[model samples]
Target: MEALNKSFFLFLASRPSLDRFAKRWGSKFGADKIVGGETFEHAVPLIQNLNSQGLRVTVDHLGEFVASEAEARERTLECLQSIRMISAHDLNSQLSLKVTSLGLDINPELVWENMIQIMDEAVKHDVFVTIDMEDSSRTQATLDLYKALKKKYNNIGTVIQSYLYRSDQDLDDLNEVKPNLRLVKGAYKESAKVAFPDKSDVDHNLKLLIKKHLLNGNYTAIASHDDAIIQYTKELVREHGIAKDQFEFQMLYGMRSERQLELLAEGYTVRVYMPYGNDWYGYFMRRLAERPANIAFALNGLFKK
Candidate 1:
């Protein structure tokens, strides 16, 4: 039943028509709960509120898979503006972006150029930037781009999905650069050939990845809302004597709001992954697919005044 719900929402996430429709209504139907807002400007105050509460934030521009060079460049400019705003507003925030939105699919060189431009601005503003991981098809390409970028920039990080079989080896490969990684139980719909199809395996694999990455002595972000995963991280770090500064917990904004505060109150670093933009349908659907409980708020959003 859970698997069916996930597949249904995943299918909805891929429909281009629905994406367009959702954009017309703006951030409605409960998307505003998870999504920051329609634009970075709209999100600035929200960031300020989160910062006031001592919750660190990473803001993603909520887009992907651009088909044209012009559109890709526009996305790059939006990211450049976002970095500047984060500095100007003095908000405690980092930038997260997708390479595809910067031309990863159109041309690798184009994406690199766009990234260099953004990284230059990010470095100037002293904002850390993370490249968000997409699906299995782009995993290798994404990592290859990240490796190239890491060589040129120190303020850059990337995500690794535990559901994928190659992620363990990817960690070993990335260890050479001493990566600061966000480990996620990947959200995209992937083939069983490339991903662990069972939830138990996926959860267990996340623990292993968390241990391996932290023991490797790289800064890690354990991006999960599950209490079991949270407890596992706490115990593992205690056993290994890992410094509290070495890792942090990350959760999507709006989901597990209380737990986020609880972790912060307990003296643990908790970063909120806040995504904002008009292009939010795909992202919101994936959130619902990730946890069916999210559907409750989404449904509530439909009838709420």
Candidate 2:
């Protein structure tokens, strides 16, 4: 299975055009079809529907690596606008932002400032913000921005990828200042030197972090569709006697609906990440690479088309 997974990922990486194809197909399927996009306008209705289904939404503006500080400022303002709109609806939706979109690639300080501006708007609207973790190269900058924001806004949170070797220490460091986090097994393709080359190692790290966070009184969001991880998280929650609402079980919008609903039915808080916009191909490609099943399905769809 692992070999198949790696082989499929390699095939995915080689086909850069597949990203464009996925995006076009995704948009044609409408907001219900894919998650993560260029803007949040197309996502609002889908988000409303998910909220109606008793699932919270995390809105993410789809773009990475700003060309300049001005662009980052504009993107930050756009995110704030989305947050304001969600707040107006009084819906169960929050914003997820990428630091690079906020000028981290140009200047770390500019990224921090952009993030602070967005958080300021969030504070005004009483909305929460989650900082999405990027590739390993930007992890330090993302962390710095999160640390700075957390010192000011208690409602601000960030993500930690279990794939990185430094993640354990990163978690410990972040926990010391603020513990609210979204934990994922990671989706970015990275070097074996800096990340766990084996799936077992990443999965093992994910389980360990869940155990550590749940027992340490932190409200960590376990964002995974793996059955064992989900079951383990539930078991840990039960053993630790953590309240159902203390944490949320998060999943991507189109993936593992059965497990998501099952957890929700069991009284666990479930948040569905409903991303939308024009730039969906990049997001879909990442999703396809993350799960071999998704890759197979996508490839079949392509051939059928």
Best by TM-score: 1
Q: What is the TM-score of each predicted model, taking all chains together?
A: 0.98, 0.91
lDDT of 2 at 295: 59
| Candidate 2 lDDT by residue in tens digits, 1-305 | 75557556656645657766655565443323556445566567777778887888888877777788788888888888898888887878888888888888898678777777788889898888998998899898789878877888898889989999999899888888856989899887788899998889999999998888777788889998888898888888888788886788899887777777788788889998876555555566677668776755665555553
Predicted candidate 1 versus true structure: per-residue lDDT over 1-305, tens digit per residue: 89999999999999998877887764457888888888999999998998999999999998999999999999999999999999999999999999999999999889989999999999999999999999999999999999998999999999999899989999999999999999999899999999999999999999999999999999999999889999999999999999999999999998898999999999999999999988888898999899878888788887887
Instruction: For model 1, give the 10-residue run with minimal summed lDDT.
Output: 19-28
Error of 1 at 141 (Å): 0.8
Candidate RMSDs in order: 1.0, 2.5
- lDDT (CA) per prediction: 0.93, 0.79
- Candidate 2, residue 142: the lDDT equals 83
User: Candidate 1 at 278: error in angstroms?
Assistant: 0.2
After aligning candidate 1 to the native by TM-score, how far in Å is the CA of 59 from where it should be? 0.4
Off by over 4 Å in 2: 1-32, 36-39, 300-305
